[model samples]
Target chain A: MSRSVKKDTLLKVAESLFYEHGFRGVGLKQIINEANVATMTLYNHFSSKENLIEEVLKQREERYWSYLDAHVEMESDSPFILAAEAHGRFLKEESYKGCMFLRAIEDYGEMDNNIEKIARGHKQKLLEYFQQLAHRKGKNNEKDLANQFTLLLEGTTSMTPLIGAEKATEYSIAMARTLVQHTS
Target chain B: MSRSVKKDTLLKVAESLFYEHGFRGVGLKQIINEANVATMTLYNHFSSKENLIEEVLKQREERYWSYLDAHVEMESDSPFILAAEAHGRFLKEESYKGCMFLRAIEDYGEMDNNIEKIARGHKQKLLEYFQQLAHRKGKNNEKDLANQFTLLLEGTTSMTPLIGAEKATEYSIAMARTLVQHTS
Candidate 1:
């Protein structure tokens, strides 16, 4: 396989492992073992494990943003519904492991700088997205709506395991109804 | 110092380190160095690193439950306010590093059994607390309300860094006013 092909393969496996485990928990050996790549091959695609870790998070950021874009299409009248649908769609994804961003932040205690930066950046975009949605929805001081709604989304994802509710997005739907502008 | 003193000292130092850096990031050596004790001192008090980890989580659970008790007493009127206030108090503590249960869960990728128990137990208690509060308030469905409010608390904590507002408790307060019953 081409290096790029192999690299992407490594990243996919790594993302699942890293997400399921965490940054520090999964090491080079495990990544290589899982990827079925030689140790040096793993190093060749990424300079170090840290870089590879960055790639995993970066991959998620791209996918997360893309998911947000495709699924959460908000028109002027339906920003709230857009946000709700976006969260709902996310919940329904085949492999749900709570919020990737929250998991990353919570897991890595002293993570590589690269991983931390990517996590922070992903979170910022979500916050900004919410802000825009609030503005689009004509919320007064939309920042309030944005911040509050962000908590609802974050809360639902983070609390899923604790509540043992298979479909957390349902709660997000109720919360979305509560948050949006109720103009019919 | 006595072994009890050494044990408490180790727990104190380790707790702060784990909170700031993460359980995996801070090794036994670091804890021993910071505690100014020998490796034997650590094992003498707690069976293993994992054991020590559980103890640290245990201490946090105590503080968390105590905090909940005081807040529930003060803001029993509204479930939302009570939940928010508890979280707010959590953020206000001297060594705030978001939720300890969350921190552990994040680090515990595959689960080592013991720590999982700690995380699971705390989460159950948290849900039960919410359920009882919701039941007392006579929400639509006590189970659903309890589950929903637990998500609120969890989600808000996860979003703390993204919001960048040091006083995240304020956001919880605003959310509480909306979600809780009108007791106060």
Candidate 2:
């Protein structure tokens, strides 16, 4: 494979494997073999497994935010509402596992600051997304509104596996709406 | 050491280490050494490392629910409210780590049904506790009420480290109160 194709292949294979079995569950050799790439090719593209993990997270994070952005504009609704809808859809897909960012933090947040920072930064950016949405709604208390919306969104992500995805999404969107519109 | 003392010591030490560095991060030998018990005694108490993990989780789950129960009755408040207060207090403690149940689920939920069941049961029982609280408050839609409260509680637990524990707990409790009273 060309260098770029090799890099993309490594990331795609690694992301799927990591999502299915978690970051800690898969090793570099597994990723290399699964990607069908040479060992040095893997090392040349991403210097270390940690570096690869971070890149995977960064790619996933960008995809998540971009998805939400598209849905937000298409729906012409609050980002909080749109994001929950997008997430619920994500959960329902066949390959859906739980949130990778939260999983990474759960697996390696304590031992590695870089991993923890990636997880925390993703969440922080999510909160900012909500803040911008609240601002667009012309709410004076946008910070509090953003906080409430973010909590509901976070709750839905965590609860979707336990409660069926459909019901969890419906309930969370209702709760988020109540928070945003102040209508019970 | 007496068998019971050895068992208790093993549990206490294992719980702390697991909380600090996830379930998969620690090993049987490390737990045994830290607990200062003979290898044979450790094996005698718990047949395998998985058994030890289940016991540690069970013990932590009991303490968590009991703590919420005590605070619930003492404050005559919603369990959602009281639990947030207790959890915030926990976060402020020097040894505070993320929620062990969620961490366990994140780590081993896919491959290990026993671990997954314990984590799921802990969450299910928490939802039941909220249902009971909502029933006590004379809510007709107890299930929905319980769902909302539990979501906020779960969100706060997950978000505490991202947003400061104090802020996360305060915001979650405010949302919970609104859900309880239907007052915006």
Candidate 3:
């Protein structure tokens, strides 16, 4: 089989298991079993379990960031609206367990250089997006405003599920708008 | 040993390991070893690993909520101000790994009924606190305000490290203050 085919299969198996059972709960044997591949085959595709895990994180990141870009465009969406839309998309996901970055941070334990870099990059992009919007609005401290917005965005994500209804996405929109309204 | 002393020792070990590592990362074996007790002794004191975990959650709950209550009673801390002080305490934690609930939730794969209950209970209290605060402030839709406030608190906790900043807490305090000011 080609590398792409093998890699795809591994990602599918790993992502499901990791998401369902958490990174620490699932093990190499289980992944191999679920993927229907021999240990050597699994290792052949990815150098080690950690690398395979990183690939899982990478796939989730790409899927999410691209989705965010599609949602928040320069041509449309006021800063508040754009930020709220991102939350909406996340809530729509059937697999929206929690923040992938949080799960990655939790599962990766001692963060590998690549995983940490990827996580940092994703967060930086979010901050940048919010900061750009604040700058567009002519906030005195765009950076500070952007950072505050990110906190509320994050705070909403966490609070929603715990808030105990399906209103997580909606709650985020309200909170995001409120936070943005303050700075603007 | 007295039941309270025995329980206290177990809670200490559980908190240290759970906070430093994670719930899944720390096993009963390790907890017992750290507590300096034989396996039977561990079983005798706590009904099972799950119960021990509850004790861990309970201890975390008490520590956090006691602080929350203290602020709530300060007479000067309007609902919003009390809420801000609570956020300040959360941010000032020495480790700042993440929210205790998120930490437990992340590792709590295949949720147990009792664990879920404890998690839900802790969240319920927080929301109630928020709601009561909003009510006291005469904020319209006090329930909604509480939901929004809870979301910000939770989101910031998880988002802090992802965004990789110490300012998350500061932003939380400032934003929380703004929320109270505007809502009040």
Best by DockQ: 3
Kindly give the stretch of ten consecutive residues in candidate 3 chain B with the minimal lDDT sum.
B73-82
N/CA/C clash count, model 1: 3
DockQ scores for all predicted structures: 0.53, 0.53, 0.60
Please provide, for model 1 over A1-184, each residue's C-alpha lDDT reduced to its tens digit, 9 standing for 90 to 100.
3358888889999888876666667787888898889988888889987788778888877876676787666774666556666665655562344666655565553455666667777778877788887777666676777777777777766765564334566776675665452311
**lDDT (Cα, tens digit) per residue for candidate 3, span A1-184:** 3456756877888987887667777898998888778888888888987788778888877887676777776645465677567756765672545666666665454745576566666778878887788777777898888787777666655654564325766766665666667764
Estimated TM-score per prediction? 0.90, 0.87, 0.87
How accurate locally is residue A75 in candidate 1, as Cα lDDT from 0 to 100?
79
Q: Which candidate is the best by TM-score?
A: 1
- Shift of residue B163 alpha carbon in model 1, Å: 2.9
| lDDT per residue (tens digit) for residues B1-184 in model 1 | 3348889989999998887777877799999999999999889889998899999999988987787777675335665576577766676664344566766776673455788788878888877777777777666687777777777777667666565434456765665555443222
lDDT of 2 by residue, A93-154 (tens): 52244578876776676675687789879988777777777777666777787777777777
lDDT of each: 0.71, 0.75, 0.70
